[model samples]
Target: MGTPQTVLHVDDDPEMLALSTATFHQFDDISLLTATTAIDALDIVSSHSVDCVVSDSLMLPDGVPLIEALRRENKDVPIVLFTAKDWTEVADVASAAAVSEYVQKAGPDDLSTVLEHVGMLVDGDRDESLAAGVSAVTEALADHADAASAASFSLDENWELVGQWVGDDELGIVVVEAIEAHAGLPAIEEPLYDYIDADALEELLRPVLEDEERPGIEVRFPYGDFELAVTSTGDIFARPEPGETLY
Candidate 1:
């Protein structure tokens, strides 16, 4: 509802990509920039004034090491480290480096909490209050499982997909429950690759995934337009325009 809040997410797991995108998209003020590798994350940090930085501490070749590099430049911005291993010892270093929060990878709950903390920090709120708010949201989401569906959707406009996934309706309330989810985070990008001319598609679409086929449902590029369809098994189909081929 406010000015768009940009959150830079660094992780390699596809599922975390799905979940984090889903969670952040729920907030109208949030826009997500995803980096699959630590180097990519650094590139984003160098260019973007992100409101929050959520980095998974296990990216191979340079995992949490990237955080130190990020700190060298953007020391004031909030950074949250997500790690599977205990970080009690590293907490001191992180504190000295000015990290806003440290989250253990217990599951989605912790990641969500870290995001909330980052948001609070961006708003100039204290970490203690932010932590309390994160706990309340996590607990409320757990308690209201019956009333609200755990699944959600997110659209990566740059990636050219609108993602939607749903969770089990029959399962009981659980914190950070993994549900059968689906997302369109990268579907539209796939079609661009299948186009007759990559440059044409890039110039026409300008990285915006909009209607290509008909009115609101189809995705169209400068080189061609195609039908976008998805099945329950996660297969994506692109019915290309005349003279265009996927291969």
Candidate 2:
């Protein structure tokens, strides 16, 4: 058989890289490369003929330098951002840089979604891959909410009424409500984003913007003693340790 297609994933998180590594085992016809930074990713592109790059937006500050660098060098490598952060902050940047796809990092299904996109890219179908990624992500978020509600807290039970998206609302406030809603307590007056270090978090979400044509993005991150995940579709998944307040 011919050699397998090579894919590169660039991220600063070792755990994410490890997770992707484990996820790729299911795809036998692919080769993988891991890089911790944009500069490192570029070096790999120089040495290897990478067919596609699955990356996190935070590989650079203002925008995705890894994608820009590849484009600057005229490598024509297909690029996608597979990330846990919302894509709005860097949406304009990624678009301007001509990224191929944007797939949310769902920890479980992210690899499969990325693989689908990469397969399309390899077939010279760019728009199809990006569109597929978006559709899949929207469905995945709704499914995740349904699964969580069926298994655990419902709106009437221990869940709080945190945030709601009416129109053109700020994401930070939405996140705050998700936390308050999860802890089974009334909404706290404090700005929740203030408590968390949002630099890295924002870096991940910088690429996602509220689009009229597409569903908004979701973000999952750890803060203090609680696990948190939020979607623009009004689902905030949270779990707190015993004897700890989630907000």
By lDDT, who's the top model here? 2
- Candidate 1 lDDT, 12-76, residue by residue in tens: 77546655664565455568898878888888989988878888763337344667777886876
Kindly report which residue stretches of model 2 are placed more than 4 angstroms away from their true locations once superposed: 60-64, 124-247
lDDT of 2 by residue, 141-243 (tens): 3444444344333233443333333223455655665566555455455556656654444433421123222334556555556656554333455556457
lDDT of 2 at 138: 46
Q: Tell me each candidate's TM-score.
A: 0.52, 0.48
